[model samples]
Target: MPNIPRNALRSLTLLVIWEMWKERNARVFRQYGRPATEIVDSIKGEALLWIKAGDTALANLLVRE
Candidate 1:
C-alpha cells in the first residue's frame, strides 16, 4: 500500500472526529434535545437507502445482522 504522511492521516482522522462530534451535537442539542437515538436511526435509514441504491460495501458494513 502507498504510504500516507502522518500529518495527512491526522488531518483525516480529525475531520472524521469533528464530523461525528458535529452530528452528535446536532442530534443532542439542536434537533431532539435528548439522547442520540433519533439521529442514529436517521443515519441507519440513510445508509440502508444508500445501500439499496448500489453502495453494497457501505450497506454490508452497516447491516446489524
Candidate 2:
C-alpha cells in the first residue's frame, strides 16, 4: 500500500471518502460532473496536501511511487 504508517493511511482514507461525498453532493445538487482523470487528480492532490501537512519524507516517498 505505499509503505505508510497505519494512521497516515487512515487519514488518507477519510480524506478520500470526504472528498468523494462532497463531489457526489455537488453532482446531485449543482448538476456538476467530473471525469475520472480529474477525480483521481483531485484525490492525489489532496492526499499530497494532507501528507505535506505532516511529514515531508512521506510526501516524497508517495510522489516517487
Candidate 3:
C-alpha cells in the first residue's frame, strides 16, 4: 500500500475482505478449496477489475505508474 492514497487502501481492504468472505462461503457450501496464492491472485485480479470499472485514473496509477 506504500505510495497509494488512503482511499485506495480502503477500497482494497473492502475488496479483499469481500473476496475472502465469498471464498469462505464457497468452501463451506460447495466444498470448494483453492490454494492461498490462487486466492491472493483472484483478489488482485478483482481489485484491478473494479478499479478499471470505477476509476480510470486509479487504474492507470495501479498499472502504469
Candidate 4:
C-alpha cells in the first residue's frame, strides 16, 4: 500500500466489510441484489456520511485536489 493513514484504512476496511455484509443479507433475506457499480457508489456515499459524522481521517483521505 502507498502511505495510507491508519485510521482511514481501518475505517475504509470496516465500511467495505459492512457493506458486503449488508449486500449478503439483502440477497439472502430479501432476494435483492445490486450491481457492483451501485455497491461502489453506495460505499462512496456512505464514506461521505462517515466524514460528515466526524470521521476526520476518512475526510482527509477523500478530500483531495
Tell me how far the alpha carbon of residue 56 in candidate 4 is from the true structure, in angstroms, after superposition.
0.4
The top-ranked prediction according to TM-score is: 4
Best by lDDT: 4
Q: After best superposition, candidate 1 residue 36: deviation in angstroms?
A: 14
Q: What ranges in model 3 sit over 4 Å off?
A: 1-4, 56-65
- Which pairs clash inside model 1? none
lDDT string for model 3 (1-65, tens) is 57777766677678889999999999999999889999999988887888868855456557745
The residue pairs in collision within model 3 are none
TM-score of 1: 0.44
lDDT, candidates in the order shown: 0.55, 0.77, 0.79, 0.92
TM-score for each model: 0.44, 0.71, 0.75, 0.92
lDDT per residue as tens, model 4, 1-65: 58889998899999999999999999999999999999999999999899999999889988752
Q: Return the candidate ranking by TM-score, descending.
A: 4, 3, 2, 1
lDDT of 1 by residue, 33-60 (tens): 5456865665556555656777655544
Ranking by lDDT: 4, 3, 2, 1
lDDT of prediction 1: 0.55
